[model samples]
Target chain A: MPTLIKHDKIMEDDWAIVEVEAPADGIRRIVPLEAWLPESGDGLLLQGECEPDARYCVAPLIAINFLVFSDGRGLSLAVLLRSRFDFTGELRAVGDVHPDLLYYLNRCGFDSYLMPDERSAQTALSTLAPYTDYYQASVLEPNPAHRRTRRFA
Target chain B: MYRYDSFDQKFVDERVVHYRAQTERYLAGELPEDEFLQLRLRNGLYIQRLAPMLRVAVPYGILDSRQLRTLAHIARHYDRGYGHLSTRQNVQFNWPELAEVPDILQDLAEVQMHAIQTSGSCIRNITTDQFAGVSEDESVDPRPYCELIRQWSTSHPEFDWLPRKFKIAVTGASVDRAAVDVHDIGLVVFRTDSDEIQFDVKVGGGLGRTPVIGQMIRRGLPVRHLLTYLEAILRVYNRYGRRDNKYKARIKILVRAMTADGFRDKVDAEWAHLEGSPSTLTDEDLARMQAHFQPYPYDSQPASIDTLGSQRLEECAFDAWVRHNVAPHKQPGYAIVTLSTKLTGVPPGDVSDVQMDLVADWADRYGFGEIRISHEQNFVLPDVRFEQLFELWQQATSAQLGANNVGLLSDMICCPGGDYCSLANAKSIPLAEAIQRKFDSYDYQHDLGPLDLNISGCMNACGHHHVGHIGILGVDKKGAEFYQVSLGGHAGNGASLGQIIGPSFSRKDVPDTIETILQVYLDLRHEDEPFLLCFRRVGMDPFKERVYANPD
Candidate 1:
């Protein structure tokens, strides 16, 4: 079974994201972007937008829902977020993260990738570090220009 | 040669380790054969009929003296002291042990090289004209764009698991030396009236079970939009390309099914969505990449060849070689020389360790220490001084590099067929050898004039038999090897697939069949009209009748 990480665990802060079965009366807390960020919330959780608009409320963490493992909409979204918006905030990738996709995801600039398990997450880290030099720059390493001189080194 | 930076080094080192583990897992039987094949193929390791063949990426065929030396060292130390230059402008070692491939890859990585993406359904080596940066007729050096495409395609996520292998060829020259017309995606870099560089994109062209000439989908696509456009095409192919039958999975089949117009619409729609996306190349990025491919330091010398005429006349062999092998360079006093490897008794494209080292030394001594491997399976010294041509020819001759049959009938492009390749239907190397033996005389070859005799073991067309003036395809008749002859194929500006002549001939009769076809060509020529033109004029009827008239 694929593991799921709530948006709260991804952030360095102590915030938890729980699914609301029902909306209660009085609680001063952050809500899902769909509920709170449409008009006023300063952040957004882009679910399936591969090419999201740069003019968002706040730094978006594109979520990858487990519709299909082969459906690579999240990758396009991550690349779009990095190349278009120049979004510097934590571009965390979440859900059904295949081990093979980790290298590309990291290159596309997903600092934190949410794999199905801790083992897979660890594997992702190792996989991302497999190659030391790349001819081209990705979101994570945006300066392939500097890497050319160091290609042999 | 673009030197790798620290990040590039780190990436390759990391990749080595990653592949090491993968290799280990495979050896440990942790990974299944089918799954591991994809992973191994991406690293350019292929399990052949006799042993594993490891293909090393040459990166648009651009290699420095140092890289060539490294290849020589690998050839001497690793395999059978010989390497085969492949059609994709890469080098292949035919007999590397499966267990030793990691070590071989590590050796390659030491020289800032890797066999990454040389095969598999993922993006293969991004190729361009061997004369990319130095050609006189070039509008722009296509290497930077080729490099850019290389980066974007390397380890790409969504497109890695494609329906079949994808190839992209780029050309900036008016003449398509890179054979762009017969690739999955052919990009021709051109400048508009406004002096803005743009790409004329062609799609769906390929060779194999089906031979296709790519259809142009977009014209005047600005340079900055290269990656975005490529992404659009890949996305379209990835999503809709066939997966049920491997044989029917190439983009050519998909393009045929959708029709060119329909496929273009699909790609355009995808591009529309990706217009302002991150994948969209920026001017800054293009500029930076362009900086890496700036023209080499060239000496200020007279461009005219008035002084070299007397020296060339002194040596008839040298004159013949110069006429056939030498190409005009963009820079003055320099010429692009193709060192043919199609010597009799040697497999086409096979270069020995000694030859590789000698070529490297020559590159450093005579030219700009850089070399290129042409898709027609020949090594090119892109910047040789015209005055030094005779001297270079002498050294090349001593080293057996001076075949003097560059574009001649004997200069065959052949693939390692049934002898090495598991996929081959018949032995192609022997056929090539037979043809080479028959046309051993340089005088005879020169008289025949600029004929391409290409042979492939199978329909894969790795030998590029479809584009040859005299094409020979190896076919299996029950358990016997048979050769099918074709004529009028050209891979230049006027590109066309070869037409099959008649029935397949037995191994013993193949050479005689080719001889008959040539005799017919010699008999039916109009003055100095080349083999292609004569074949076109006379049509295949004369040649076909002659070839099949005395069939064994």
Candidate 2:
């Protein structure tokens, strides 16, 4: 199972997220974000390294933490993770994931969006096809750039 | 006229398809509001106070009869049966639906027109003298150079996302009718001692909260290096212009922060880097663009225009119009006639559908079917025979397009402020109406002499109030609307920013304030002095003292 971290709160050893509390005894370590590489530990949760230099290594089975979706730093982070960093892990967007921003979040390569509940999560999926075409380059589609170049050429 | 070739036609056709797809995507919920806002604005669609306002670009203010008729048809079918001509020489429709904009653009593209780059942080329309090619005083036809600039600047990758919108204007004549000094970049084409056409470049001049008259940076630059030099300026602005604050984002602020000399050094450094870039203009390219704007076939006349001077003397109204509205044309028997839109009860630059159609017909009936929109918010018949003046005036008067207030106070330049714009602090159109209503008499306006009264709702100076002889600015004082009066501003061969008179006045007191200011000019003038010279002869102290001395 993919691990998830609430970026705003610190977890004690007994806090288990699935059981609504901390686990009694598991991996009892608080890894500072700078040293916590995706390859260093299995199912490790990380947050707050928005301008990561080496984000590509974490491409497999990593649950990134988004403190707030409206902050817009997360969108850039997600784009970097997908396009430049090539992170194809289970990209779950958590914390303040408004239903309105899900379309952009999905385009930026977020797979499983963590909203308030299941109904709102369905609402997020509905916003994905709001427009037909775009003029600028985006991560989800590489066709717009080609089409514009051919036309202007 | 620059006829659209296959390349130009295909480009606009493809753009229409592109915009249609974006509209579909927006309606399908794939594009978010904020993201779509940027996209639509780039296509000249603005979500104004009540509805979407579409600003249609009139490239360098030149249009033929078919284009004008197309605009009239659009106004009739899509808008409120009318359109407003803007000070930037574009036509704005106030009520285009958000979903119908793509179709609207398609219709415009059929006539070699598009709203692209009319809004957003890109190079807005490139303007030139309304009498560019036909003016007797012109050193060269500036339209070809303007067309070259348009091609170079349109959809430019590096410059599209500037800190703010940029404007460039060029004038080939010595008279400076294009108001080049108030633009972001201004070029004046003149022949050097060797008879080669050269450009004098001016940069970082604009009208806004900080109104500035541009300073000349390069003198007698050869015409070949125009695009290269422009690219240099844009690169410097894009890389270092302030983006942290929108108000301080224009190149003027950046130029001001690092004095003009320092800015010139930086631009030179940037030009050094772009010395051999592909964006540089080639002689072949210049020739190709020049071929598009070749002079029309003219039939030489047997008689000079002065032969009809005696007939105008018999009709006083036509005589006044001939003196004020007619400009010297390069052709012997022809004149550039400015048909003022500033009638007594109508808003400045507001032309109904019928009026638009009539003007289109007049263009065909008078000279070549070509028309131009002046920066002063008037229409120009670039070629009209001097003998046809009375006949054209008769038709224009019947259509309510023959107002003889071309340079008078009633012909004010106003912004669509509080009524339409979301950023306006006060209403501008109504204030303009109040001023026009007070000065409706033709005799009174004629006696007042040539005066440019400009109004802006806010300090952004969309109305270009800073360059008016009598400038009125709407100010918000503690949530209440007020008017600030200024005098001595001029825009022409000689340009200066107006100085604020004193404390602001209530909206009800504005018309009286203007009357008092005009009275001061009338009382203190020499026989030959215009309003500007009179204001300069006796400084603002006398006008300011007279205006605010009696508040009641």
Candidate 3:
């Protein structure tokens, strides 16, 4: 079994990802965004294109699935969910989560991602820590680059 | 030339690490090909027909001697011994492994350079006039503003993933050598009577499948509002620009759909929110940017050098080289020498490693150790003493870099066509070569005078074919390649797109057709009237009739 990298830690992911929403087995089952009930302490599942505006209200945890899609709408959606909607809950990126998208996903909002295997997951995690500084203000940093830089005298 | 501070240096370092991770993920099979393509392209790496082509940015076409040597080192080590100077003022290496691109970016970062936004759908390298600081006609130098825009646009988070690629060009010179009118956003920088610098902001000008002359939306915008005003235009474009079809995605299509006036209204509405933002340029910021471009310490030189005069009187080649290749400088007795890369048989902008080293050495010897790359695909040494002209000309000729054709017919802007680029419809280099060989005679080419002949392999218009005095476009007809001819195009002051003369011609017939068009121009033009001015005065009807007269 592949080790899951979540919140900078390697651990066994127990949450079962599912498509439909309904009477769930408490927080163990991650259901579709539509099935996410308010304050029920349910985990919500999101398609790459699913809007995240209402996720902040109900879901205790949200997992955005990277659809077998070519473009990167999922990445942007994750970024917007955190940066715009201020979704502070445990965010997970699943489905066809390419190893390369992990660093960007981490920057965007995702605290965890489904990797193919343990070795690949560990390698992907290593890529994230190399950049000691970044240009843009993101989910990692709230202040933009202009505010971060030293202004000319 | 601009110097990098700690902030600039650190940003590049971080960017290299970021791109390196992206490449590592792809190599490790963690990132899929499609996802990695976007990341790699933004770093100026493209998978071409033969091999991967990596484009390294030279911001506003400016590079110092150290940067040039670093480029030479990269070209020598990472790529083949030569590099092609692109029309966008970036250097393209046709052969390189994708795996080594991050390493290439790392090397570039050490020199305060990165390939960020050189490709992909975002703001590109902010281009400016090649003679920006030293031009005699410029009232205020545009290089500072160019630097300001470049810094603001790099790693721009919001606009990184735009509907289509965006280009911005600035020019402070009276003559628009930068071709500002054909850019996505054209900033015409100038000073008011009170000596305050301002910009006449023009938007939605681009050359591609659809060619356009950018409409001036805002006139005399104060320099203080530079970043905020640009932010306004980009926000509007990002939100409203079409994304449905790639062909119709450029800002020009958006501006045309909503008339220029309507687009201006939208931008005005957007600007209202950003006008007083913290991003606005402060006096200190302006001074800091300007400090990097302080005037060179020029030694007063005689108006005419005795040796140069004697050489000119004796050797016809030296006289022709000076007349065509050299440009007048703002500083007295100094001249800007253009080292033409458009030698016969060679591609328009291809320069070798030894040549680059030679030019870098010459820059240090004759002037400031800096170089500028023109969009016309030539190198410029901005400061050279009058006395050094004859000697420089002799050395340059020996290197085959002394084609005394700056604005002449043979000095064409040709793109790397089907041979290297997958997007090309035909080969542009061969067509340029055929035309150059036909008019190789210096006397004939000089007599033709000031012809902006441009050829593009495809409708992407990388060569800016639409703005050429005589534009030639390679069109894909069925499964075969054909050439399309256009007339009366010009990129400067009165910028206009060339009108198609007739039906597309076979590749073999292109040179003859151009000859016929020029023949008609020679017959019709008044004394000392240039080819473009004459063509504009009479319209394409005259040339059109003659070229198509013997058509089957």
Candidate 4:
């Protein structure tokens, strides 16, 4: 079983991640976006290049697939999915995730991460929220530092 | 200069702590080398030819006296006693231990500075005219917008890991002093007839393997929509930019592949969706940022012009320094003074710790306690009193900062080539020094008039060789070093790329080749026309003929 970090804490994950061609018959399995029908209540898995559309907005969980940690297209996709499409469910990051990338992944609105192992999951938790404040607006904070904090001058 | 408030200060402090942790993890072997490379690059540390080179962001080229002292302290205490000023208005330390970079970042943060996003595949330090607020030709000061962009781009979540490095430049002056056309995103800020601030946005212009001028994607965009529009552009680039080949990954390649109109359509589509989001600048937001850049309290009384005129008449060196280095300021009694770093023997932008301290002291005594670094590798005192020009010039001459060559040929922009950069194909500083030695006479340089001589180690064009009036590019021929020369390039108003003269030259023959080209210009030029104008009027044929003709 893979380690999971949900809401910034290590936890045992029960949701199943199905591949694009894999059969996902149950509601607990997060099927690929192509496989998940609108009527089916199964969660959707989105690739980095997937079009962020409103059709998949009703999914209970959307796990963004990253082929490599350095490919940042999925980060922007998550931002658009949350801020523009108003996807208010569990946003998870899966595949090729590393502890070094957790801080940026969290900032871009990943609420859950499927880590490689237990030790890496702990490292990921430590790196998250390294900075209490940030300058720009994102999915986590709609208001930037200038709008949220009281400036001296 | 924009002062960092409590909110901004705290953000930078937290960043230093975060970077420190990252460095520790890498050292402990918990982080992989490939992953650590990206993390360290985001903090502006690059593993170079000989050692690690640390680049500190100057933030639109503006620095205060305190920040200058801090940089000097870093130079004295860290890996070296000297630092090199980059063409992007930032400073680079040639040698810094990788383990000690966090300490350097901590020192910089104490002065409200950081190296965040300086040299990663992300947004770089925003640059503008060195004489931003004081220049007489500009209607609006570009610093406030530059600050806004700087904050927005710092540690930006989605755009931090782009396919290639991105650079943005802003200019508000009638003349393009910031070299906006060569940046990833070039913004020309101006005011409408009704006193409304607006921006003309250009996209996908850069200098690297492929040096293409940026295209104007939008015109007369209101100031409030700046961030949203920028976000739209970045998002489009992040999603669609090439990831296969590093050389073809810049946004310019994408823009070229899609064509300007097609790329503009894509950007417009993206912008239309997010034009009025939470990122839109509010009236209060605009006012607050504008307040930070209000005009300095200049002396209202007119400077003593007769005294200055008498001093100039008395000393020919003072007159020449004033004629070449001083620029007109918006305020009547003030002047913008450029401290030339290109003193004959020294590498173009290299400055010692002592020189940094001296410049800081001069900034406090002669004008406001503020300094600026220009893209042409020179320091600028933004608010010098016209009456005190003679005194400052005399002091600067002894200090080697007063070279009486601001835009002249010897004040060339040369990059740290094979000496410091691992990516360089050939050495550049030696060629620059040889040329400077040949053209040592002030009378000859003054008679020759304004010329932009740029040199780069390789096709990366860090020295902006493509836009130089006389561009020299270092090339590698069968593992041996060779020099390629280009002519007729200019970076002002209507910027144009230079054309290669003929063939490559040996290192020993570069200076004489340049002399031959200049001789052609001198022989053909009418009266007092500048080198660029003369070259433009008479095409590259005459110069090419003169140089390549049998030199028996």
* Best by the DockQ measure: 4
Chain A TM-score relative to the true structure, per candidate? 0.64, 0.63, 0.80, 0.90
lDDT of 1 at B114: 91
Off by over 4 Å in 4: A20-27
In candidate 2 chain B, where is summed lDDT lowest over 10 consecutive residues? Answer: B273-282
> If you assessed candidate 1 against the hidden native complex, which CAPRI class would it receive?
acceptable
**lDDT (tens digit, per residue) of candidate 4 on B119-141:** 98999999999999999999889
Clashes in model 4: which pairs? none
Candidate maximizing lDDT: 4
Question: What TM-score fits each model?
Answer: 0.85, 0.80, 0.88, 0.98
Q: Give the TM-score of candidate 4.
A: 0.98
Give residue A119's error in model 3 in angstroms.
9.1
Q: Give per-residue CA lDDT, model 3, range B1-552, as digits (tens).
A: 788877778778888888887788789997768878887888888899999999899999999888888888888998899999989888888888888888888888998998888888878999989988998888789999988888777766556767799999999989999888999999999989998999999988889999999999999999999887887787677667776788998999999999999999988987885677667777877887899899988885456645477889999988998899888888888889899999999999999988888889888888889899999999999998898888888888898898899999999999999879999999999999999999899899999999999999999999889999999999999989999998888898989999999899998999999899889999999999999889878988888888889757
Q: How would the candidate models be sorted by DockQ, starting from the highest?
A: 4, 1, 3, 2
Q: Say which prediction, candidate 3 or candidate 4, comes out ahead on lDDT.
A: 4
- Model 3: residues with Cα > 4 Å off, grouped in runs: A1-125, A134-153, B300-307
DockQ of each two-chain model: 0.23, 0.05, 0.18, 0.76
lDDT of 1 by residue, B1-552 (tens): 566666666677777888889898789986558657878998999999999899999999999998899999989988999999998999999988888888988888888899988888778998999888888899888998887887777777556667688999999999889889899999999888898999999998888888888999999899878888898898778767776687898899999999999999999987886786556677767777777877778888554676678878898888888888899888888899999887889898999999999999989988878999999899999989887788899999988889888878888889999999999999998888887888788777788887988899999889999899988898999989998888888887768899998888998898888888888888989889999999889898988777767546
True contact recovery of candidate 2: 0.00
**Model 4, residue B539: displacement in angstroms?**
1.4
